[model samples]
Structures are given as C-alpha cells and as structure tokens.
Target: MAKSKRNVVTHGLSGLIGDLLVFRQRAGKTIVANRPKPSVKPPTTAMLKVRGMFRKAVIYATNIIQDLTRKAEYEKAAKNGQSAFNVAFADYLKGPEIEEDLSFANYTGQTGQKLVASIIDNFRVASVNFSIRDAGGDLIESGEAEQSEDGLDWVYTTTVDNPSFAGGVVIVKAYDQPGNETLVQVMV
Candidate 1:
C-alpha cells in the first residue's frame, strides 16, 4: 500500500475539514476533533485595588518605622555621650586648680629642711632667703636660694652661687632658727 500525504489548512476564524481518509491514514483510526470552549475570567479591579493599597501601606509604614528607629538611636547615643563627658568633666574639676605646697618644721638631720610655702609661677622659682640667728642675734646660719613655686620647698639651684645655711643650729639659739626669714620675693 502507498503511503498518502496529509495537508492541514485553516480559512478565516473557523473552518473544518472532514475526511475519513486523512484520519485513517494519519492516526490509523477514526477520531473526533472539537474546539475547546472559551473560559470565563474574574474581574481584576477589586483584587488589584486591594493589592495596591496594601503595598502602599507597607511601604509607608516601613519608611516611618525606619525613620523613627534612626532618630531614637541618635538620641540614645547623644545622651550616652553627654553623660560620659559630664562624668569626665566632674572628675577633672575634682583636683586642685592650683598646686600648693606642703611644709614641715624641724625636719631631722644636721641639715635643716626647707619647706615650700608658695608658688610664684608654674615653673619659675622665687627669690627666697633664710637666716638662722643665735639667742645673741648672731647670724648662725644664712642662705640665699631660689625655691620651687611653693616658697617653702627648696630645690637645688642651677647657679653655683647658692648660699648655704650652717649645718646645725644649737638648741640654745633655736629660737632664731626660722626668725626674720623672707620666704619669697618675686621680681617684677
């Protein structure tokens, strides 16, 4: 048997070919063909409106929440920083504004100890003099020296011309030990 050629064509919107020979030759059997009916679809208006509204609401709410979070975080950080600075400043002020001197009289040893009484400046020393006199008013010990800012305290002078006080003053003349002392004299 010779194989037959099949042709399929359509004209206009709808057309049908009826030939038992085509069906038998192509599929080897009799077949019925039918066009599917059009399906009905729901309207998109309500669904689209609902989706758009929810999307806009979510976007707006997200932006508002983010802004609020950022502002709150900034406020918290500023409060923390301010508190820290306050604490630090309070600590800073707790110390003495001007450094002062500590003095002691009758410090032990043959050499008399000089206690600083005042400060001239932050670094410069003040011209100071000390004299030890006996009960007879005789100069038993004399010294001219520059002391640390606090006049009572004495530091070694860079100038070798620093005067020396007698190593020891006799107890009988001790009444004159610190008498007539010019503790500090600042040069203008």
Candidate 2:
C-alpha cells in the first residue's frame, strides 16, 4: 500500500482506476493499493457464518442510525472522522468483554459481600448480571449488578449465605447497548 501525496488527479480519488490498482480514502488521506483478487475457493462454513453475522451487524447499524436517540448515543461515542453508523456497526461486530482475572476474594458467600467486575465495550455497557452457583451446579442467587457512579465498574451484592461456597462458581454476564452479551465464570 502507498499513500497518495499531493497528486492532483488522485489526491482525493477513491475506487478502482482499472483492474490493476485501487484507490481509497481513509483517515483523511488517499491510499493506493493493488486490486484484490477474487477468491477461487468455495466459501467455507465458517466464512458463511461470518458473512451472516456481518449482515446482521449491517442491519443493526441501519436501525440504530435511524433512531434519533440511539444515533445520538452512538455519535457521542464516535471519534473524529468516524460516523455513528460506523461505531454502531463496529460495536455490533465486537461485543462487550469482561476483563479477565476478576477479583472474587471479597465474596465469601456472605449476605452483604460485594463483587466488583470490570466490563469493556466499544460503545457502552448497558448492564451486568451475576449468578452464584453451588458446587453441585445449583443456583444459589442471581441478580443484576449496579453500575458504578464513575461508570467504570459494576458491583453486585450477594443475597444468599452459603458456607460451602469454596467450590462454587460465580458467573458474570456483561451486555452492551446492541444487546451483545459476554459471559465470564470464576470459581469461588
């Protein structure tokens, strides 16, 4: 790939000039590259699934930009030269993620014990849900976590008391504005 520098004809040009070269604009600059060759092999199942997922992302972005309220929300998250539709589309493709190595040391199956989780998303995390299960996989408690005032962490207060929580599991699910969910599990 080469950057177009002060070339009069191709300075702001985009699209293919011929079958040999392709020109595109990115980050307020024109880029020139060789035309990509069409794949000769048949699409694999994984590739088909990815294409379907991207199609859904496109539909989601279209709906989001059409709604004034949601569009404004995404626009606020967009950076310079980035559109709300692009942000929404990228958010749809990349779901929320729960930071690994979450600290569960404070949770001891006590009624008032608290668990804090850090969730990362491209745009915004709408909510976080936590579920506590026993060693036998029996659900002990489940509830929605409250987002911190600074909007960095989610805190969940334990409701049930189980002395035998050492071998139990705590599951956390983080959701984004696009309804994408990321689930993480930690052993108590």
List candidate 2 stretches off by more than 4 Å. 1-6, 18-21, 24-37
Query: Candidate 1 — which residues are off by over 4 angstroms?
Result: 1-104, 107-109, 119-126, 149-152, 155-188
Q: Provide the lDDT at 53 for model 1.
A: 57
lDDT of 2 by residue, 63-176 (tens): 999999999999999999999999999999988889877869777788988899988899989999999999999999999999989788999998889899988999999999
Choose the strongest candidate by lDDT. 2
The CA lDDT of each predicted structure is: 0.34, 0.91
lDDT of 1 by residue, 1-188 (tens): 44323324211223334432122222342333453444587648997887675565455434433566533432343444453233222222222111232232332323545433332321122244444443344554455544555443443222222133224232210111112112321110
Worst lDDT run of 10 residues, candidate 1, spans 172-181
